[model samples]
Target: MFGLIGHSTSFEEARAKARSLGFDEFADGDLDMWCSAPPQLVEHVEVTSRTGKVIKGAYIDSVFVPEMLRRFKTAKRKVLKAMELVQRSGIDITALGGFTSIIFEDLNLLREERISAVQLDWQRFTTGNTHTAWVICQQVERNAPKLGIDLARAKVAVVGASGDIGSAVCRWLQRTGVGELLLVARRPQPLVALQESLGEGRILPLEEALPEADVVVWVASLPQSLTIDTDSLKRPCLMIDGGYPKNLDTKAAAAGIHVLKGGIVEFWQDIGWQMMELAEMAVPERQMFACFAEAMLLDFEDIHTNFSWGRNNINLAAMDLIGEASLRHGFKSLGLEPASSSSPALSIA
Candidate 1:
């Protein structure tokens, strides 16, 4: 009964990651309502770890702020219903998917007839997911030659450079030797700070940055008031949008920029028996959401779930740890799809 709170690709992918890490079986029709319950919930509640127990007994799902709060409310009710059904069917463990884990902060308030309230905090889950996205993207770049993408000389623009995801990407690009990295954001100070921290490169506002970028990652965590129009972006760059309402406006994407929905790919180790049907199915990195990577990474060490990364703060070391864990878990990036270097890179000309 994991509630996929938002409609964006990242949220759904995160939801899938939750399924991979927490849920055991994935039947043909997930909505069928006839699949057998997980063995842990039915007969082996305490055979393993406390953290897994905490997550298993919880029904995780995604939920954003004011924009989709209503959706969260609705999803909350549906989950409550699912818990009730599960209780009647002799199952006690609740379903907590990755997105649901985001909203876990408010579990104390969630009250059902026979079950404990759900817990979540979107801010934490989102930041964790975004951090994982940054780590995952970099790892993908490390193996980009296999994917026919290059990062050594990539002209990249990070839309939310001032924030956690954007800044992390900037640092990652620099570390990986991206030839020209352009960071864009509303406030230049944070971007400049990141630039200063990196001890090199350019950090400019969005309007001045995108024209010549080879790969542009728009992972801005924006408010409802913000929407990126075509006039604000340049042409033909690979646009990776990780925003909720979507940072790449539909028309702006028409400017010939190939837009990709950033996502995560999680590997399930302990649940191999449950996934025997798809034994060889290693979830492509694109299949999981960034937050799920964050959770899975944290889950591995049995650490408490928290907002470990975001725009408010920059923790490069923590980001590195998450990146290392993903590589160990068999996840890789989609690589940088290069545009012709001969074309003018920036609009300043």
Candidate 2:
């Protein structure tokens, strides 16, 4: 019995992937994978994505303050409550996704029960091919010849440049020939480092600098409740929300600011269920997720889990590698949404 725990709403896609990995999809339309039980062939465990169902567990880490510790304790209590329900219903292998894995990422919760823990890398696999910034830079350059969007004429502003992802984006902007680059972040250290690495430029914090930018890229993991006054964002501007959980409030963002969202090209073949097994077995070892490839490969010969690469700082190289790998593997981008008739959307968000 494999219990995949995640928000069913947001991770319907991941659930599908889990099914591809041998989980079965029952008549209820929930994921049911073949479970490795003691001396038994297999069993069925339902994956519930419903809310208010208690999820019992902990993500305790060695390093944290008292306040953080209290928060973890509360979260663990909630998780344990949910897991208790699943146990009563009969689930042997419990896997956590999204935020659940964040808590378990640090602590070993499986030791407390008969449940097995799992954390699917999802999108953030780090491959060595290209960095996300480099990949975005390449897209800018690649599209420069074809893009009605001119990079040379654009006044660039990279928000949160004091951080890793922001710094990479800034470097690419600098080299890609922005007419002017406005650096926005917290303190002045990274801004100074960027300037030193790429020569003199104007740098300011995000609040003071956003109004003048023609192109603004947000890449930091800001806390919740942080809000951007849409009016401060420039008109006729292109805003790229590159941060996970999204930095700019999509709802509150200025209308017509030309938003550029980011995501990898996912190929979901409705080749139906017929060819799934073959595809799984035949997927090349090198075709693993970019983020966990090296680590995951350490344990197995067929390291195809990370068919797409990932990184915290958004490695453009990993992005490129995933793209290149998918193409080489003859994986066509699935037609999704309005794209249900066209190709999958692949490129920087």
Candidate 3:
């Protein structure tokens, strides 16, 4: 079984949980955690490729913003508690999901005396961002044509190109073929290093690159809203909103830009019953975000290694491997709706 740590973006989303916990009220940074045994699987789901792959798990919600995670004490407490909960629930591997992975990126609880005393293997914990990048690339490729932008000859701009997701997207775009890639981020050195390492893209500030881009992907970190002169983008540009809080300005969509949020994938089968309940959301049956799917796929493959970790670690080979596995397991890039052909979403397999 695989486990995941998640978080809510608003206090309203967790208000009931807080009340159930006997609290009079809930604040923005409040945390919640729970475990699910042998997750709910639909009957027909057994006929799919993921057939015998049973996933039971636990999740934690550490409300939004990095300010709450600035102190090491908070991260350590939440990380350790979440780990203990998953371990005690009989989960074999626990994947850090959402901001939980970002806030606790380099934290090693196994090295701490408290966890060392328990003798749990830290290797069982993996960051789900690897497969996320893979799916993002697939989504881009699948949707590019529908958006009327040909990636092979389009000027692509990646916001937050220095971040884990943005960097990986850049690497994949470089390999997949693009007319030009504009790397954008606040940090210059890492952007320069990444540009030099990739040896393909040109490093430019977000402002300078925005007007020249035909395809814009927003993956910047929190508090840094993606501020671009959308009117200056090449005519009929493709904009992908791939950030956690959704960086794209929705107004741009009304102005005729094609925008698709990151982490969304189309599943060929109905395995969403239990997964939806676990997430506590009313997601559509066939659609799932790739980050959550990563843990489920890893559990199905029975590969317990720390597959993806650290910043800027996602590469072409790993992305391809995971992409292939996801395809084999009934996950496709067929967009959110079957009428996706008429929509901005791409129908990829």
Candidate 4:
């Protein structure tokens, strides 16, 4: 069976969800109490593909909240414990969603094994980034024209261009004939390397690139202190917020500036799961994060392996493979109307 490892966006949301799930203890627990809680397997999912293939899966709540981010040791342990649970459950393949994936990649957790006598098997886990990049690219290609922006002539800027998803997005856009590619990130050396590898994109500061971009793909975390100047943004500009805590709408709201949720996909039919409800998706039954869907796609295809892992390892071929699988199994980029209409208050898997 496949699996998905996830967490709540905040402690309050986690408490509410815990109560809904009948975890009364968790419902009353404080952040510190939550940090010490064990991961929970909250859902057993059955999804049927358009091709009539059926797959079984489970959702493992890491019991992690964004508030734990400052507590590095707690954050690391939460992710590792969830991974350990997945491994012990005998799940064939699992996707690390949201910050779970980020922690795994950032901490280089692959070197870890034998979590309290359970040997961790790296092959059973996938970062699910390949499909996410593909979905984001598809969103850009499909949505830009609706706003009357021709991608071939539009300058696209990728925030967090040096990240795993961001770099993959940059690689894909390079082949799309965009007018120009602008790379933005916090660090310079990686940005320089990415620019050198692409041999095309202009590396620029986020402040400078925002005004010039016709389309902006954000895969980075927005600093809490940062405030976007909507007045400075181009009218009719498209912003694809692919980052966690997806709050760009609140920050960049303005006339003629369209913000679309990036890295999301819609299934043709209900997957008979309620996990998305916890994620607070507008259409919980059908809408889901592309990263989570990747695990489902892999399970449906019976490709029980880590299809996506490691940093900067995502290539055009991998994206194309997963993209094709995604469509064949009846998953596509969610439409602009639903994407724009729904504003999930918290970031989640």
lDDT of each: 0.46, 0.41, 0.64, 0.89
| TM-score for candidate 3 | 0.80
| C-alpha root-mean-square deviation, each candidate | 10.4, 12.2, 5.4, 2.9
Model 2 agreement with the true structure over 138-257: per-residue lDDT tens digits: 434443333344777776777767655566667656755788888877778767877787685688776777777767767665566667676776555565555544335443455545
TM-score of each: 0.53, 0.48, 0.80, 0.96
RMSD of model 1, in Å?
Answer: 10.4
- Candidate 3, residues 226-299: lDDT per residue as tens digits? 34566676677766777766545543544556666666665655553443443443244555557767776777
Candidate 1 residues 214-325, lDDT tens each? 6677776545454456554444456666654444545344655556445434333233222212112223212345554455445544454443532346465666776676
Whole-structure CA lDDT of model 4: 0.89
Rate residue 4 of model 1 by lDDT: 19
User: CA lDDT of 53 in candidate 2?
Assistant: 24
Task: Name the better of 1 and 4 by TM-score.
Answer: 4
10 residues in a row with least lDDT, candidate 3: 34-43
Which one wins on TM-score? 4
